[model samples]
Target: MKKSKRKLAAIAAGTVAAPLVAIIPATSAWAHGYVSAPMSRQAQCAAGVVQCGGVKYEPQSVEGPKGQRTCSGGSRFTELNDDSKGWKVTDVGQTMTVTWTFTARHRTTNYEYYVGGRKIADISGNNQQPPQTISHQVNFGGLSGHQKVLAIWNIADTGNAFYACIDVNVK
Candidate 1:
């Protein structure tokens, strides 16, 4: 019985260790929208909406000041900023899903979700909860090719936005 118990323990350890060992050190898995750090790393897309990492945004980042979009869509007053840490790309396929958690002030907060720079959805509310989790999944005609997804958060009290964009190459 003792020998059998030892064998079982060894088998369990191998089960856990095998997966860890097989993971390539440099392999990149899809993560929600905080880009890979060191600040210089970035992904680009054509002139439209794009999803990258865990967040989505309209237009490519290469445009810099010109590419940024307002959370409410079609405005030049203020730009997308992340007070609640904005949305992140959770998964991508025929339908792509993006999610993020954030805290809001005592005022009304407006969150807008977008695909390819077009406003797809939005939620607005006042003084209810913090660390609110917002998520969206869009079916792009069943993942025929590349699709762009973006989420931008706008707090009424503060005119800044937390925004991220990603380019999903659907398979």
Candidate 2:
């Protein structure tokens, strides 16, 4: 009887501890998006483009503060911003298709792409859902050699955004 009771207690503790053991204290309601194509930093972690800790399971959950051009999602995810992440650079032409994979389809305002800290393209999301993947055609006309492009999916109702940095070798 004591062994059974101890097993039950352990099960109960594990059930409670599961939520607390996350790298980020994120609830399902808040995590919304990540760029899948061009393989954003977080997506790279998911795709094994680089070695990342917990982000491999939740690539779409990079919920950092607004106006920051980082892929870390800020704070606990700051390792994503490290310059030596060994991220694989994708090769592309003047235009590339960026696909965003969402876990929770939040109302979205728009999608923006930046290269060398300059806004290159601004596309519309306008609060959509399901269907899983969102794709945008972005032009990298003025960029050459190697560049890191910042892709953002802006949440409509909140001041949050899903940030991704994609390394590319422009052809």
Candidate 3:
């Protein structure tokens, strides 16, 4: 009958759309993450050490394509990378540990720390899904005075990474 044919067509359409609806959320929401300890740029914003707009509300969202080498998360959150706002320098020794906080864990690729555009530390996450908190210990060597350290968190299965710029005074 005509009703049977219409029902079959509707079932086919629903089957096709189900995969798309499920894939959309599985990719986006689980992608958010950010560094917390040692006070990253977003952490400063969230803590009111610096003034920020949307990033203060959603620190985990300051992410962009891996290897970009800058913050702001690709313009939607440019305030994440803004330096004129002035951040409080965290007092750090020659070696310090930085931590990342995530609501949903993902298989991590690696963690990179850069000072003055030079890579000072690289830690492997080994495609392991860490706990809610991830930490990396970095050595700044003889570097002193005020400096900005850019930290990148690359995800294993995705080409995206979360970026955080930490201001520190190496002591």
Candidate 4:
């Protein structure tokens, strides 16, 4: 009878621990933000505008180490790095408003924008938590034609940053 009790206790412990084991990894990988306007690569994936992998389920989760240049933020969402992924290109003038939609607002260092591997704009975040929606007017300068814009949100308290890639046609 003691052996049966021990077996039942083990089963109960396993049942209780299984869910926590599953939930722990997911909690660590929870992400916060993404570019909403201009339809970032992950945003497109989430909207079903493009078929994608895991990123489609969480467009705002493309979080990785900062200062990396890839749209995926060098994370597992490598689909964002595919240049031929048939992303819709939005046409805009010399300047356009880039908007970010945040699910969880973290204290931010700054927002950076890059085009053709060149830093085009850097908007200071003042190391403060942002609103649910934030917008920046990014000037393309002399850049024109088809271009891929990389947007990065550097978190003040972490080494990770959220990344988004926007395909656009500058007129």
Candidate 5:
């Protein structure tokens, strides 16, 4: 009788843990988007252009609280914040089209672009879900030389945002 009781408890624990294990991967899937063109750091990781950690698996998952300045959005992908990581820099004109690829679109507040910690452009999201792919024309405003452009997607209904850093050489 005692052995049977122990076996039943173990079975009950496994049953309770099974669903939780199944839900773990689903949480990571909640990540929505990333800059594809001009190939953001995460995009490089996903494309095997750069060797990386877990962010290579989910390039769109570099999400955290809004109003962040770092490339990782204060997430666990600190690798994104490493400027020495040998990120690829794309060459572009003074005015270039930046594109984003979405895995799961969310209602958006606005899209913002920054250079040297200064906001360069702001495109209204109109609080709507964007298409699977969207592009914006951003003028570097005569800013030249190597620059890191920080792109942020603010979700309208959530306090979180997705982040991508695009390294570029303006010529």
Candidate 6:
């Protein structure tokens, strides 16, 4: 009789404590916080399919202030708003890669790549090729060891293009 009561109590305690135990670790991991990249400058093309797009480095990090933000750190606030094509940035800690893809319909367009506001690679005039991919790996160049990279794209033309951005941590 006494054993039965004790067993029931133990079961009830386990059921209540198990959930609490699981939740604590999850909450801690969630609170670790996230960081974001700097910034990239972008603009539409004036003549050809491609235009000048520079990288902008925000000298300071952005504190959350108060509320939680979907993005954190000094990420890129500049972007290339073109519905035709796609632009993406992949940050691999040591090296950051930015990729731009466009269709032949977007010929005469130009794209400029930069690291820390310094022009790194400039691709001009689409070769009138079919939908393709163009990518460049940028060396942050004596950065602060590990840099949160930000990439920007400028759709200088009105044609069609696909764009995406990704961040990869090498360390």
Put down candidate 5 lDDT per residue, 2-119, tens digits, no spaces: 9999999999999999999999866644749999998999999999998999999999999999999999999999999999989999999998899999999888999999999999
Predictions: Cα RMSD each: 16.0, 6.1, 2.9, 3.7, 4.3, 18.0
Candidate 2 deviant stretches above 4 angstroms: 1-28
| Count of clashes in candidate 2 | 0
TM-scores of all candidate predictions against the true structure? 0.39, 0.79, 0.85, 0.84, 0.84, 0.31
Q: Which run of 10 residues does model 6 get worst, by summed lDDT?
A: 30-39
Candidate 5 or 3, higher TM-score: 3
In model 5, the Cα lDDT at residue 54 comes to 100
Candidate 6 per-residue C-alpha lDDT over 1-171 given as tens digits, one digit per residue, 9 for 90 to 100: 999999999999999999999998654432111112322212122122334233222211211222222122222422333323332323355555554433222333444433334555555545443245455665645553332233333233332222222233344
Please identify which of the two predictions, 3 or 6, would achieve the higher lDDT against the true structure. 3
Superposed model 3: Cα runs more than 4 Å off: 1-20, 23-25, 73-75
Per-residue CA lDDT of candidate 4, range 54-87, in tens? 9999998999999899999999999999998899
Q: Report the lDDT tens digits of candidate 3 across residue range 1-171.
A: 999999999999999999999999877656667889888888889888888898888888877888878876474888776688888789999988999999667788988899988999999989988788977889998999888999888889788888888889999
lDDT of 2: 0.81
The 0-to-1 C-alpha lDDT of every candidate, in the order given, reads 0.42, 0.81, 0.85, 0.93, 0.94, 0.36
Which pairs of residues collide in candidate 3?
Answer: none
Give the per-residue lDDT of model 1 (tens digit) for 1-171: 999999999999999988887785322221112212111112222112223332224221221221356332333212333223333323456765555443332233654556656766666645333244545555566444544455554444333444544545667
List clashing residue pairs in candidate 4: none
lDDT of 2 by residue, 1-171 (tens): 999999999999999888787634455457578888878888878877688888888887788777878767573677688878788889999999998888788777788899988999998775754357878899987778888898988887678888888899999
